[model samples]
Target: MFKINNLSAGIGGKTILKEISLDIKPGQVHAIMGPNGSGKSTMAGVISGNDNYEVTAGELLFDGKDIKDLDPEERACMGVFLAFQYPVSIAGVNNMVFLQASINSIRKYKGLPPLDAFDLIELIKSKMKLINMNPDLLQRGLNDGFSGGEKKRNEILQMLCLEPKLVILDETDSGLDIDAMKAVADGVNAIRDDQRSFIVVTHYQRLLDYIKPDVVHILKDGEIVMSGDYKLALKLEKEGYGWLS
Candidate 1:
């Protein structure tokens, strides 16, 4: 469902991802593990159409079409959802209002009618329940004054509601306690099926214990240094990246 061929990218004048190639098939969950500054987050951002980085080489394709030129909103409309590592808190932006507009925009793009107020509320409630999120969250500004766990669960709630085909989770497990992590993982696992794909990016393998990636990749510097089945994550957990040196 997604392919990155010989992809190289950088922000400003510095290169971060170097000739990184990955193919995420439908229903496959791929986990990328690496140390700090290893370009994992950059890979997710580039795939999500973040304009801060320029693609220095190769192509990014989604569903067999080139998406290197598309904007972030266009990519989201195309079923690409990136749950950010650090969800920003935006004051004065009603959470429900933002989500309603977002879902409606995607629906309109697909030649569907905007969900009416009644239907929208129903959808929100169901998604909130799936992630065990508090409905009271909607009463506040988007992520404003929310705890780390609340923000992370809110991200999962958005992904569940959108039903995205390709989900890129950029360090979704960061700062999450065991219970919060389990809640997020359960929400992700609930939506897993044969037609959806996921890219799980993280620094540790503990998160993989819950999500169970089909493939595990170890990234070093700007390139994929090693990749294997789930055992690879276990190996990294024990050996760490020092073995590579």
Candidate 2:
């Protein structure tokens, strides 16, 4: 569903990712593992169309169309969802309000009728249950005063609600306890279907223990140094990146 061909991107005229290429097929989960400053998150950012970075060479294609020129919102509307590494707090925006607006915006982009209040409420309730989220969270400001686990679960809830074709989760396991990680992983696994694809970027193999990626890629210095199945993650856990270096 998504393909990156020799994509080199950077911010402020400094290259961060150099000739990175990847192919994510439908219903497959791909895990990207790397040490800090290895361009893991930079790959995610560039794919989601973060304007801070500029692509100096190569292409990013989604569903057979080149998306280099598309804005972030446009990429989102086209079924690309990037769950942030650090979810920012919106102090005044109600969670349900934000979700409704986001969903409706995507719907409108696809020429579909907007969901009414009743339908939206039902949808939110159903998706919230998937992640075991508290209903009270919907009434609170987005990510405001939420615990770390709560914030991560909230991100999973948004992913479930949005139903993006390609889900890019950047460190969704960071700061999460084992139970919280399992819950978040369960939510991700629940949403997996024949038409959906996922790119999971994480540092540790613990997250892979729960999510079980079909493909594991070791990214270092802005490029993928190695790619394999789930066993690669386990190897990294035991041997570390030094073995590959």
Candidate 2, residue 26: lDDT: 91
lDDT tens digits, residues 1-245, model 1?
Answer: 89999999999989999999999999999999998999999999999999999999989999999999999999999999999999999999999998999899999888899999999999999888887899999889999999999999999999988889999999999999999999999999989999999999998889999999999999889999998999999988999889887
lDDT of 2 at 154: 92
Q: Candidate 1: which pairs clash?
A: none
| Candidate 1 Cα deviation (angstroms), residue 15 | 0.9
User: How accurate locally is residue 159 in candidate 1, as Cα lDDT from 0 to 100?
Assistant: 92
The per-prediction tally of clashing pairs is 0, 0
Which regions in candidate 2 have their CA more than 4 angstroms from the true location? none
User: Against the unseen true structure, what C-alpha lDDT does each candidate score?
Assistant: 0.94, 0.92
Task: Pick the lDDT winner.
Answer: 1
* C-alpha lDDT of residue 84 in model 1: 94
| TM-score: model 1 vs. ground truth | 0.99
